[model samples]
Target: MTDQAHSLSLPRWKEPSILPGFGVGVGLTLTYLGLIVVLPLAALAIRPWELGLSGVWHELAAPRVTAALKLSFGLSALAALLNAPLGLLIAWTLVRYQFPGRRILDALVDLPFALPTAVAGIALSAIYAPNGPLGSIAAKVGIKTAYSPLGIFIALVFIGLPFVVRSLQPVMQDLDAEVEEAAQTLGATTLQRVIRVVLPALAPALISGVSLAFARAVGEYGSVVFIAGNLPMKTEIAPLLIVIKLEQYDYAGAAAVGLAMVAISFTALVAINAVQTWFAGRGRA
Candidate 1:
């Protein structure tokens, strides 16, 4: 058989590589990630090792540090959980519906990205303080929001909401509506269609959004400080504790607390990603 004839017999889907860009792209990607991500993380891990095991444990187990850890991790989880459903609805609305001021509403979701954390903190505090309009209304109802744990939760929510919305927006946009229609044709109820078809497809993106929100909230500082009142052992977040330690020239202590938060966030993120991947595999199957 001739070479040309042999080639013609091959399937159209089989194409020989005629370009050499793959190696260059892969090498560049690895080098960039190594420099920007792996190196800094390695430094963070190594710095705390300079302190002995006893020193590290004591630093991390200090009352203030422990409280800060709880505040940061606990509040971040709560904020992400709160954002998940609302963000899903927002994403669905943006993708599935058309209304007046739709563009403005879409733009508003990204406001937190452009707005400074300090400005957001101040704005929230002003609006929610006892003397402010909203605060006065809340005060009449015996609820205090600003300068409290609630304030921290609100700040975290403000910043984290966008992550989930933006992450799911594209996924929802690309979702196959035909599948839902087919399911409905088979007599599946709306809830069953969502649970059996839509939710499975959106799971990866939703999990990604949740993880991003949690990570962002965990390390947040400026937005939380003003509203949380920086109260020790009560409303102080882990990032704020790190700042306090830095202010007092306690580098070792600051590093310890920062390292602990980093570790926890990293582990949680890993778990979320694993779940996402598992769901994606099942979806593909």
Candidate 2:
């Protein structure tokens, strides 16, 4: 056959199959992705366009809007930061050690994810209601746990923790114990072994977990509203503000806030991805 004929006759793509052909798989995947992700995101992106640029700017720059945005982003970041170490420790204990009720402890780590956010929020509010046990202790120190920004942070931490723990658990499970044993055999101290051997291996996964938790916390609403007291410019989060705007029939304002939050979360996620890349590179280096 001529080279041109052969080239023309060459297969271009996989043929459809009866059970699970590449064509069927790819078609189904694209269809599902379009319906679930792409369409909704396109609608969201187009929403603020109904507002002129100036209108969107004014909506986002309003005092109440700015305060809610700042509170939401700041508390989410703080909660994710706090979750990193605690989640890592919990994941490590779960992965590395087998103790009494270890299976129960592991199962409980997923409670935040399984529990309804509204129920979690109500439970947290009850626990931190000033007359509640933990709330009473916090009050003794003159710290308000509920109906304040602190309460938002606490609720965010509660909901965000599961992300970090779940993200790290599988990675930690795949890590080899022999590597640590070898490091110790070479006279590496505990701190040195952890720093030089363990942390670099875990850094990428840890950052990813933190980023996931941060993103989750940023958009959290149900579990946060009860604890936030819904005070405008005080404890109200961005999601709550968006809901309030929607309730007041200020659709454009809500869209503007939603767009701003998407922008902020995307920026933070990109920065976190860069950090993850750096950690991955350092591990190779």
Candidate 3:
């Protein structure tokens, strides 16, 4: 019996049961989340219930509302797509190259996160305004950057760059360079090696980054307003429209729009997550 008891596995260092402690921690966490996240979202959703079906439909289907939705979502998607390639290129250089000012450039990628959105908007507006250096050159060609959809896209791109870069950086660091070297040794061309070997490993991170960036840009308000010109049915965005509705004392209308945006953004995020799952499954398979 003694030998059998000794042979049996023993639980590691059980001083006391931690159930009480764990339960308290979990309770606090849930309470905090409820107050901060769930409460605000629930309030937004509940406010729309006061609006009847026709009233809700009228608010949502208004031309200006539709225009704002389209512009915000469309520009956000474009910015994320544009950033994906540019971010990958930047990440590749930061990881693979050892050039002058490389460290400084890498540090600069995170500037948006630290910088206030309002400051970023002001700076971008000044740089791309008609009289500004690049804008002046473009003006000669009859192109305007500020106070347009183009400006909105640029702002989104500015804010979203860090997401793509940070997401891809660690993945790039972990990626084995030997795989590429082997592909090269086997007579793979530059593009062929990159397409076959380099991209597969980075694809998951890239997708995640793109999705995150798109989500962020979709909700971006501060940096876009100044540059977007906020014209109804033109440069107006969903967030601004919601704010406008609130200013008009149309709480239900504002909540309705906010709810719609939340729904759409949530759906997009879900789809992206499904894609990520499929990719993960494929990797395992």
Candidate 4:
């Protein structure tokens, strides 16, 4: 009776499962995360403080660093926003319609995922160079495409589109067409059905995709470096600035910039997740 009471008093750590070895699985998972993720981030966080708080602040306060951070974060957010609607359109088309070459188009959406960033940058640069086809057309209109912030925006959009598309595809596939048909039968207009019925169902996945795209764009280096022209206070990005700092043997300064980027990115992602949570709650309510 004592043993039975003692066992009943013990807290349940997890639900009963048919599968065994939960302890082993959790131990391995934590060990893997500690070594692979926690250790590196700990190193990054500690390295910057070697410069002291003031020194770290000074490094990040530099005009060039400020500009690069702004450009990188700003354009990354913009690119993610643009990709939301465009990716939704593409995913909708792929999942809802059948047409010639639809399979090819769906496969092509994953091109950015497989392509090397440097190769993508080079191709984009060539296409948007002043004398190149699209570049020539843009230049004729007194606009610059390559070697500018516009170019950085383009590169980000290129890399980010795949995230949004792929994230939405599975959700899109699961969405029943009969729901839309039912709405239509209720005399709902196409726009009304989409805005009310479809968007609510898709909001979570869409936000997740946008967050992923933003995160990827924020850290992008190879693809952006080639087209950014690496100009100071103009088109340079934070990752490129960190690289320049490392090349100049300013390890502390580089770490400081990296730390700042991590902080900002974390804050932004938190905000996005909060919105996602709110949306999920509203949907449930």
Which candidate leads the pack in lDDT?
4
Alpha-carbon RMSD, candidate 3 = 4.0
lDDT of 2: 0.92
Give the clashing pairs for model 4. Answer: none
User: Over 4 Å off in model 4, which ranges?
Assistant: 1-12
- Per-prediction count of colliding residue pairs? 0, 0, 0, 0
lDDT of each: 0.90, 0.92, 0.91, 0.94
Tell me the tens digit of each residue's lDDT in model 2 across 1-285: 986676677675533234766776789999999999889777777888788888888888899999999999999999999999999999999999989999999999999999999999999999999998899999999999999999999999999998999989988999898999999999999999999999889999999999999999999999999999999999999998888889999887888899899889999999999989999998888
Model 1, residue 239: distance off in Å is 0.6
How far in Å is the alpha carbon of 92 misplaced in model 2?
A: 1.1
TM per prediction: 0.90, 0.91, 0.90, 0.96
Whichever of 2 and 3 has more TM-score, that candidate is 2
Best by TM-score: 4
Root-mean-square deviation of each candidate, in angstroms?
4.0, 3.1, 4.0, 1.9
Please write out the lDDT profile of model 1 over residues 91-206, one tens digit for every residue: 99999999999999999999999999999999999998899889889989999898889989999999999999999999998998999999999999999998999989998999
lDDT at 203 for candidate 3? 84
RMSD of 4: 1.9
TM-score of 4: 0.96
Q: After superposition, which runs of candidate 1 have C-alpha atoms over 4 Å from their true positions?
A: 1-23
User: Model 3: how far is 128 from its true place, Å?
Assistant: 0.9
Which run of 10 residues does model 3 get worst, by summed lDDT? 9-18
